[model samples]
Target chain A: MANGELKLLGTWCSQYVIRIRMMFELKGLSYDYIEENFANKSELLLKHNPVHKKVPVLIHRDRAICESLVILQYIDENWSGTGPPVLPANPYDRAMARFWAVYIDDKLPRQLIDTLKAATEEAKAEKIADIHAVLELLEGAFNKCSAGKVFFGGESVGYLDVTLGSYLAWIKAEERIVGAKLLDETKVPLLAEWEKSFLAADCAKKFLPSVERVEEYVRELLVTKWKVTSA
Target chain B: MANGELKLLGTWCSQYVIRIRMMFELKGLSYDYIEENFANKSELLLKHNPVHKKVPVLIHRDRAICESLVILQYIDENWSGTGPPVLPANPYDRAMARFWAVYIDDKLPRQLIDTLKAATEEAKAEKIADIHAVLELLEGAFNKCSAGKVFFGGESVGYLDVTLGSYLAWIKAEERIVGAKLLDETKVPLLAEWEKSFLAADCAKKFLPSVERVEEYVRELLVTKWKVTSA
Candidate 1:
């Protein structure tokens, strides 16, 4: 690799990793994608992200940037001229984008994981309800943010889109495993519609892993890591 | 208030709120600070931040930007030509600053709270050890980021300084309550020195609450919220 070359350390099943991959595609930036195995994390990943030791570390010019959201912001700032800007141009809009992106990361993933980890039928139902509540809040956010525009970035997929859209596969996989519809069209029509459109996007198609693949990974996670047998 | 006027919905004791206050002072921006009661949170705060309903909500031109970190970035972007830049001009430096800021927020406060809420001496000792480990890492970060300079922002206080600096009062309070020197001079000498310099800075003196106030608040929080009896 040449000096100033971009390289991403990630895994296939990670939504956080997928977010960066999607961003790279969106920017039309070419880079080497180094896949990491979670079971046996590479020294590069460990050295780069000593704190979390998590994947989706973006190595640019031999300097590593860890955390998915942080990586996304770095890419946007570093390659501002090369891409359709990841964050909004206006300061207030940018704040809102950051706010919602953080919200999605804080709420959705944990709730989705809880829904999977739920032992009893009652617990699963309760967790599913919590997920719906979060989705409803996000639905309101979508309406407020989009402002009758197609995407959160208004006619372009930006930061929030990648943040939330990265989880679509997992959401679908969870839905399949739990035998429930997490993103019901009737409840959150806009998000349901947005999902279709986001999935249809060129970058998303190139980067997003298959729902089946995520489903398999999640099932294994439940069995091996979580110590719960699949239904 | 005129259009684009700033109003901060916050409580004095909140370190999250202190961060924004410090940022405002650093930027030399004036704003109306509305004190909120946590026991019965103000409707204004609830209205502004419907999702979190938590403060340090920066209401600019009547548009609310919730979350301290988000608000800090917004202030930086909106007032790019202000007194001092909150974030670094260089992209990679900005990313590093952000990474450390996030790490500080993720580790410190929670560990401090756990230390207070620890039911046993062993638990408290473990939590204290965890905090020391985090501080040790932050000491390394201070060296890496400062690079022979006084502050994390190098020549002046920037994003990372304000972020980790906001928790100074709480750290002091935790030290007092637990009878443990959290920022030990011997262990994390760099952070200890940095703390003194940061506290002596103009913005910190103006914004940071007294250590006694924070100690009282934390003790009360222990009794009421966590149901833990402070020693």
Candidate 2:
């Protein structure tokens, strides 16, 4: 057992923060949840996660971990003594799982950022193109993942689902703001149903942000700051 | 053993590719290597990785998984039955290892990309600010990770070294583009030595691109693309 109380430092709005929280919930781990006003950085958060100076930073007794995806793997590794395994017992499945997670994290963000930064005609055009490209890729990935099955795992949700679900929450909001769309049923049909299934899933439903709020926030972002963020 | 032959579609300059190659080497799995030309992406590469159309795609038989970091994890899981484990046996150390890798992969690139983008004063200033912020945080992280000893794992190279070593190859080139320093003996001294130790690790040195070439490419990027890119 860890030497001290386990604590998680995060902002409520952060999807990554929600992810680790869900992992803890699924894992049945008891821990302290410390909210940080990201607008005002806290000493504890700063000390625990100096590199990113962000959350959710999980303080495991004395040790702290800063990355959300990494934290998920850690929690799964430590707490997955029983119940549904977060990663595949088989190596190939686990790798594929990690691949999807990393793909969304690494590739999707760029498209989203480009969309967020679209102000001019040319920039908006470029961002839209980027969004389309990402959507195509996501469609391929999710369809392959969902091959004759429901989730990233054949039967149900796994770590990859959690990560992707978190990411999907922000896409529409970003699209609305950037004045572009990503997932249309006709376009990325796989994602359309995946979103439906994911939102309907009790875990994703609880962990994901309310769609209404996300929509409004994304609209506001598009209307207000997307252009002036400076190239 | 897997049922099919493995093929790796990758670019020569990609840090992610190098990381996966190292993992393949570490795992003692023989894979067919096919280099990709980003400008003229091959049909095989496109078919295999339709989503990203990027390098670092691994093919097992005919099923392909794209993304380098993801491939690294996949390779670890698939081939780790008899070889040295890529993930640590202990969960906490595994988290720490993932922490470093994710930090390098996700956060480090922003600053390095900024340095690569040839931009105006405003863009340069924004990028410089971003670079400084990341460096300051990394400084603290290095200190935190190094509180006890030299390596992320006592004295041996682990996951962190793999990610960080791959990235450090680009830093010198990025430094040339920025026309300002980020890592220094005076600034991030711990990280500086950490870099030295990372590069000196077995097989790590052989895997990376030449600094001179990277610097040259980075300089060219600064002249042509940095402004538009970081902007």
Candidate 3:
């Protein structure tokens, strides 16, 4: 069965959008990347995802799938035989992959935003400390999930890899803005190494926005949206 | 493969726990249900789920899976052939199911908590209004997903059904405490009808905690945890 007329509505600098792009790259699936302007969202985007009206809406066969995680699962399930499976074959491993992916989604982004929007040095440090704690936990998870392998998917870039890996550029940008090492090689050596490998992976390399690009975007976001000029 | 030594560690009044219990009933898989005391945290629960230290942990063959949504998926995949499929088989429908399920989890609980913790009548009304808006959207979703059928899963209970259905008791309890009809039949007729069918379903009947029980538990929660005297 043909997955006809696949179209993706997204913005350039969104980590969530990058996750879907990375999935398409890994699965060897091509899609029409429709870049959506945040200031003025497209009707297609709005019509497809009215609830959130956020980006990363994948329109396949004229049906739109909103939410990046949901979209990733749809692609994996729909294209089960196309390439290396995004989720693991074993049910337990798949569950573990989802557990960590959800953990990343739940924790990392909020902390990153807080770090960027911190009003004082004291507050920024506090947020950084929380992020470090989260990273340490993720480091342990990486060790458990990888089990002496290359990625969270053992050998290939699986769901967890795409999930956490999508934030690599943003983490770097936050580090640049805040003057703190988030993925510290000494503290969370595993994640630090994983970051290096994930960035170099063929599937992720082109999709991940450069740290410099993300830094510029974050600065603009702070000024225009969040009204935080201190950063 | 035999699913060996299944055990569930959860509290009696937790809607999340009820979701797992209902899934078990739906699949006809029995497990030892160990009720955990919230004040006196169990070492086993802590050890199994170190990160969140939350309940609704499903331990199978000495492996623990935490998070309600993740556990539901795990159960569905592990016991795929044993029972009626919880998630829709079609990729697009599955994505829609997940999309709606995530929406319910993301929106409903926080609004309910805010309603409970509202210090002023105005604030409570505002929260209730938000909840009603969410419910209205869900009502539309129910129409689309059910497609004139009885439940969100069409003929049988599914991921979205279990996810949102877990909160039915809590919704009723909130209505009782706040003196507001959250699921107004006049406003959301489809959801109102769906609620009746969900409660009467064989898989969910014995598992769903009664409205009175939930109300009592929520009142206790307000006084003890949230420190609200006026509820």
Candidate 4:
């Protein structure tokens, strides 16, 4: 095969893609990027990830890992020999990190998908409400971890930050998509601050796709999804 | 206050409760069972888990661990420390395990919840069809693994097994609550066999509430929820 190092398989402008990128940059690990046009998925991606057949596939050596959260965990586990572990040292805090990951995953995904599908005002509100409810839970959890903390577990950015980092772009996009902001400074100050901290960090700033790209991708997705729904 | 060991805060026939029980039994850990009245949740559960206030809450040495999957991971990491990790050792295999966990969590929860909340025949069939789609995905995944043996990974009742162990009781209750049989051998043969293998395992058998008890609980939940929807 080709040069055997860390290669991330994902589309440009995807939040999930941004996540894996930010993790590598944060870990200071060098990697190769293979952006896929999901419309015409590559044979390598298809064969490597036969199950999900989805993008944001991370190929390390010969092993191909799918799922963004799974990929992040895999990155941390494989590279744990060096640098700050993405997961916390304490088991409970690690579990809480995973717990939030699962919560955002379970609760928001349907709402997020449907938000794009939503046409009517009521439908959009329902979708927004679903996202708000889960965000509220996240906010309350962060609130308990003490104020003015850079990370979720108080002081340092760990698994929670990495997990939440992927979604910040989408949260930013939602304000434009739905015409309402969920993470305003006054409303969810702590969470809003976490977002700023996450993006402001050097690693995230370096690897995360440009805002122009995120806006372009979200705009295209929303418009394309609406076209399919309307027809 | 009395026994400084383990405490489980859950409903009588919770799927989440059964999962934790399976892990505890697998590791032979002993604990106290404090069934929460979720409707009027206790102050202890509320205080311990201010974020979600959800079950099954595991209180270990008075520290609250909320969310069933998170609690399962914690138990495996802590108490079941000296065994084959519930997660796969290989990175790809671990991704596969987490893949199914995330899939079931994402695609199935809402439909399964609606299946429990179904009122009439029309609602029931639609929900059952939704449930079937998930079962089909599981069926295909399991069939691939079952070509050799049982479980999604073929041989062991591991993390994905426990991650899904929660659903065994919930689905059995769905059959009772909605007057439907969603996990039948005829429709989803692979999943049906998976269910049998899971149920027969000593760990699963120990944690599972009596089928009669789960039936009763589902009926009660449906009645309560049904009243609100109709009103």
Candidate 5:
């Protein structure tokens, strides 16, 4: 239905990029994915997203949309007729979906990274506590909002599923690199089950980066930039 | 039209709270505003926003929504029939509105705070330069998006207006505390003009905090917490 070329600029291992890709697959839309080199960014990436100059920029008919969650909303809204709507039809539910997505995107990712890059044992412990607190909150949110539902979207993988699902591989990678178990099944049983189902979903199976690749990237990052030896 | 009681919990000086108040006024919605004491927050505020423990939490029909942008979207969507839609109807335009709002909410506010808190003159100068670069980008965005229009929403004040307008008073206060003119007319004429029109609007004039009060708060913050006497 789209009249013009739809191009996506992203890195292979970025969770944000994975989000857009998964959304496209779920929506059954076709688009070209251009893998951007972080060391040497392309002119197209820079030209499209001059402000952030970051990845996961969606170019539709040459109109670029940056930020993953924003791109997801754009994709859903533009393709409302064809795809299962990423946001709920009800206003309140849409707000709730957005609220959870923001929590997953803004809060969880940074905390996970910080847990990995903690400078000292004390800091790591504190960061782990913070992560647990966040997880508990999300666990409650998911359990309360998603009762007997296959996904946060109900019946199928919704916006929240795509959002948190994008980070599944990274979370696993952090488990190996950080040597801390964040998503303990006992603590967050619902999320644990949801993660399993999410990964097994057709879209996730295709788009999610391999756990080994994510682990390697994390290990390399720690050694080269943070000057830490993987234990 | 609505059945439930609407209550807003906010601090006196927060720009975010002011955004909601302005929206309420523009929409002609009657709601109770409960001023939150930052030093000794009420149990209600804590309960509603457990994760953030922050202000500007809106209670509609006993459902609490936190985060300024999320609250704004909630308000807009719930009251779509009454007020001018905060987000444009077009999907692309909605994405644009959200993109700019994120930039204003996430990027600009923290940078401005950092510019104020910089200890050394050299660091302050660097922060000021960074702020200028951000302003130049915003200037271009506002000018391009708001061509021949009074606000970013086109005819009347829209989402971007509310997002940026909330910070208008705080920006004025920063000018006094930092003692370096940031939003000079020569540098950002469009924004300067928009600022005047925004503050003069009935909604803004009534809801926005006074420059004197914001300056006083900054003065107290520097003296008691930051340990810096104003230059």
Candidate 6:
């Protein structure tokens, strides 16, 4: 939005990268999108983010910022006067939004990773239980926040929505990969509905990959890298 | 600061709890400090933070906020006008601050944990090297931000300072416990000096455990819990 060039170093498969993409689309900002090869990372990506050396790095005005949530906050703050604010104005509500966003980014993803690595039936069962517990908690939070509203932002797609929405495609892919129905409509009806709304949103639809593509990538990942047979 | 009551659920040995304690002290707010027995967690903690069930929970007017960094941000936002701001006024700088704070809270501590669990000298060395690489990066950030300034907040001890400063005592105890110098003053001179200033600050001095006490606690933890011998 300012002087220097804006660029996003990202990959198509990353939910984190999708978070930034959605933010950029929502703000209607133009930037050069550099797709990083996940197997062999680009030197530019590593140079900008030497600490983590990962993708989804936002480079604006020669300064690099990593961590998807941090970048989201940056985008919102940088464009404060322009578009709809991703974070709420109220201090406590902002805090609650941040709390759930962190839950989505930091907490839930790790459990999903562990579930992917489950070796035996018992291990898979335990991981599934853990994942369900977290999802149930999130379902409750989603229902509470989005009650009588289209999204977590209430009448618009906001911070908490994007945070969890980025994972919708990956969640579907995981269901296929794990051969399990994770988000049953009867149990988590609200979240299931929110998932539908989130994916159907204009911002998400622009960047989110098809569920079929994500499933294919996940299948390849599990079969070749993790040595897990597709369930 | 506002109309309702402020209460902190914490424990003496926790660096996270120390963060909120220091924040409250810096803000000049009065709150009931509830020390939780680590062995037997109270029902209040479980009820408030049903997900994590951990310490450093901030309760204001009966609404609970868990996660130390989340609680810190909540305090800053809720008491925005009363104290010197914890986050910077500029958007990009705020993003940088959040990035480093997350690196300290999420990334560095886990590496340190792995170092502690290293069984052999070679493994410990590898972990130590990994830890140092991260510290060196942090050292570079601290020097860039604090160039001729008192704190990361330039004139005041703010969010990033507290985020990294909370671990000063733990770093010291870990050095003693591991029988290796973690923060080599020659390498991380700025961080070393910042650690001194942070510990000597009025807020930190009030809540920070003495080096002896922390060392004793770490020693007990190693011997009884982890079976790590004090070098």
TM-score for model 1? 0.97
Candidate 2: clashing pairs of residues: A95-B74, A137-B51, A231-B231, B117-B226, B118-B226, B118-B227, B119-B227
Distance (Å) between predicted and true CA of A137, model 3? 1.0
lDDT of 3 by residue, B1-231 (tens): 354499999998887898899898888888889999999989989999999998989999999999998899999999999978888898888989988988898999899999999999999999999999999999999999998999899988888888899999999999999999999998999999998899889867888888998999999999999999998
> What pairs collide in candidate 6?
none
State the displacement of the C-alpha of residue A196, model 2, in Å, after optimal TM-score superposition.
Answer: 3.6
Candidate 5 chain A has its poorest 10 consecutive residues by lDDT at A222-231
Spell out the clash pairs found in candidate 4. none
Q: Write down the worst ten-residue block by lDDT for model 3 chain B.
A: B1-10
TM-score for each predicted model, relative to the true structure? 0.97, 0.77, 0.96, 0.79, 0.96, 0.95
User: For candidate 5, what's the TM-score of chain A, rounded to 2 decimals?
Assistant: 0.95
TM-score of chain A for each candidate? 0.97, 0.87, 0.96, 0.88, 0.95, 0.94
In terms of docking quality, model 5 is high
Fraction of true contacts retained by every candidate, in order, equals: 0.97, 0.91, 0.94, 0.74, 0.79, 0.76
Best by DockQ: 1
Query: Best to worst by TM-score, what's the order?
Result: 1, 3, 5, 6, 4, 2
What stretches of model 5 exceed 4 Å from their correct place? A1-4, A119-122, B1-4
Give the per-residue lDDT of model 1 (tens digit) for A1-231: 364487899999888999999998899898999999888999988998888999989999779999899999999999999978989899999999988988899999899988888999999999999999999998998998888887888898989999999999999988999999999998999999899899999978988889999899899889988888855
Query: After superposition, which runs of candidate 3 have C-alpha atoms over 4 Å from their true positions?
Result: A1-4, B1-4
Winner on lDDT (1 vs 4): 1
How well is each residue in A43-117 modelled by candidate 6, as lDDT tens digits? 889889988899899999778989899999999999887788888887777888888888877677787778888
Which lDDT tens digits does candidate 5 get at residues A1-231? Answer: 354499999998998999899999999999888999999999999999998999999999989999999999999999999778877777777887888888888788789878877888899989988888888888888886677787888778888889988988998988877788888788889989888888889989999989999999988888887777643
TM-score of chain B of each: 0.96, 0.84, 0.96, 0.85, 0.95, 0.94
Better of 4 and 6 by lDDT: 6
Report lDDT (CA) for all predictions: 0.90, 0.73, 0.90, 0.74, 0.86, 0.84
